[model samples]
Target: MTTSNWLLPEHLSDILPAEARRIEELRRAMLDLYRNCGFELVAPPLVEYTDSLFVGNSQDLKLQTNKLVDQLSGRTMGVRADMTSQVARIDAHLLNREGVARLCYCGSVLHARPSGLLADRELLQIGAEIYGYSGYEADLQIIQLALDSLALAGVQNTSLDLNHPGVSRALIEAAGLQEQAGEVLSLLKEKDVPGLRQLFEATTGVPDDIAAALIRLPSLYGDGNVLTEAASALPDLPGIRAALQALRTLVDALDATSVGIDLADVKGYDYHSGVSFAIFGRGWPDAIVRGGRYDNAGSSFGRARAATGFSLDLRKVSAGLAPAEPSRAVRAPWNSDPALGEKVRQLRQDGNVVVQFFPGTTQSIDEFVFDRELVSDNGQWVLKSTN
Candidate 1:
């Protein structure tokens, strides 16, 4: 029996010509946008040592990473599951700038498993990062950039969900529940009020007020009023107060129409240390972009700079948009004439797509529309509308 040689593994696929072209166009446009915004471009290696790849990353990132042994050194190497950590490594160790460093990157990332049931294991991740800035100013800039990115991709009616882990983290630490931080965070993320109550009920040494605040987190999600309610509902721990204030500052600063606050939505990498965010398009189920402050992300790379950035799967963004219109092109006859060659070259130089077909070549390509054709009129090559 023979299996199909062209078949790809599950959750992996080849991007065909049309989709590939659209994704590439979007990539170039986004990179230009980043550049105009003062972000210097950087490209990190596709694979690195597991130690470096997994540095300060969450267990989710480690599990998602595809690992292998480097035969040259007989050491473990892994394909990056997320480029954020690699970008952090570059800022901390490679650039080593004392002042703020704005960097952007675009590349392929591999995951051992799909992020969702309909998701692919491979992604074209593109994003921008700002290093050496820790203020709400940095967070606001990152957030605006993310919103601008979505707009550039023609994604509209998007809403922003804001969350700060410090709020929940503060309660957990103040209550001496750091040992159960994982379980507590999991429950809160799911908004499992019952589970949280049960955990606090059985766990000893947690103050009643802290447990109550922990249980209330699942309910502390809504419009701007959530912040006011949180200020009154939750205990006034320094971490909680600071986190709420940070969220308040951003909510005030952002001009976006649909902004939300979800105190329990700490569903990102564990490295996210401050105000974190997820931007969602109107109809899409998942966030179109995710980013936030991770001041400690670079500590493992040698320098602990303040870092904030956002990343989105370019392929996913392309998939959600309408099919790209076929590019208009001029059909040219196959010829060895120097004049014809020069004419074709000049047209292409002027940014026109000119397709030259062989003597018996069939017109079958779907990526370009042959709207016009090059023809000989009185010994001069000229463009004639096919229509």
Candidate 2:
């Protein structure tokens, strides 16, 4: 690349001042929200050993991770494409808390490629996690917390799509189609009815009931009523029945937010073993929040804990939201007087943004539109309104 083109790389750009301010404001608000909910903030390293980082059912994360050799140790180090795995490691090995542990994290994760045509290769991920809880209560709490976070960020007209991977997994296992499960799962994720039918038809010795169940999976999407339809349509396998009951319980408990169910929805099929959810705003094309229950993610760290959590891209959440109220600025004249310095310090200490004017400046200090100015009045320094 020529020097003239030495700007930002493809799918990557700097967040300028205005956007940066908005992102920071949202970040602080989200962290405060998590803190109030009893979640402790944790900052994991930007990179870690590839072996440890790729633990659990995270083949997608492994593909997205950017790998490089750590010269200091000669071992492959990977820039984290997701922070959930790191948090799991911390909970299982580092903190190793006995009871339920609530933790939150906010940081940048790098992806080797963009998620979509217009997606960024880097993202500011913020989320909260609950470990040591396996029941539907934990899932409901995390979902409610996610809704709260979106509300705090000013997201409106939101809808949540909920699913249980076990529903489809159970169907596949019961069908004796474990060998072709990967292909079947991919088709389900795409909602490709024709493709699924073709695959099933071409495959020999598929049980008639199982094939019919697989075909119905893609169409089993709608509001809470779909759960009833699913229960009646799917086979009488224990896992399938249990998953449907879980979804029904969640739907019955929810009141304020709009919810839907997609029995074939398996975005994180391999990673999330239980209920999975994605939040969609009115105008956003992609999900703003993606989370679910990944109970076995911490197994590699020597302890497997039941965990449920959600994460959102802070930058994306703040994109169309209103910026926070700007702080009042007090412009003070550049002077060597110790009293003047003390006054400036006092103003700042009282929660005001004070910008000192520099001597020999060509531009007017007032050009910055400071809300107030410190000037001599009646032979004493006083704050004069610039408005």
Best by lDDT: 1
lDDT tens string, model 1, 1-387? 887999899999998888999999999999999999999999999999999899774889989999999999999999999999999999999889998999999999999999899899999999999999888999999999999999999998898999998898889889898778889989988899999989988988889999999999999988888999999999999999999999999999986357899999978737788999999996677988999988878889778898889999999999988888889999999989899999999999999999999998687898999999999999999999999
Q: Model 1 off-target regions past 4 Å? A: none
Clashing pairs in 1: none
lDDT of each: 0.91, 0.88
Q: Residues 72-151, candidate 2, lDDT per residue (tens digit)?
A: 99999999999999999999999999999999999999999999886889999999999999989999999999999999
Give the C-alpha miss distance for residue 48 in model 1, angstroms. Answer: 0.7
Give candidate 2 misplaced runs (Cα > 4 Å).
Answer: 322-328, 362-369
What 10-residue stretch in candidate 1 is worst by lDDT? 264-273
Poorest 10 consecutive residues by lDDT, candidate 2: 360-369
My TM-score estimates for the predictions, one after another, are: 0.96, 0.93
For all candidates, what are the clash counts?
0, 0
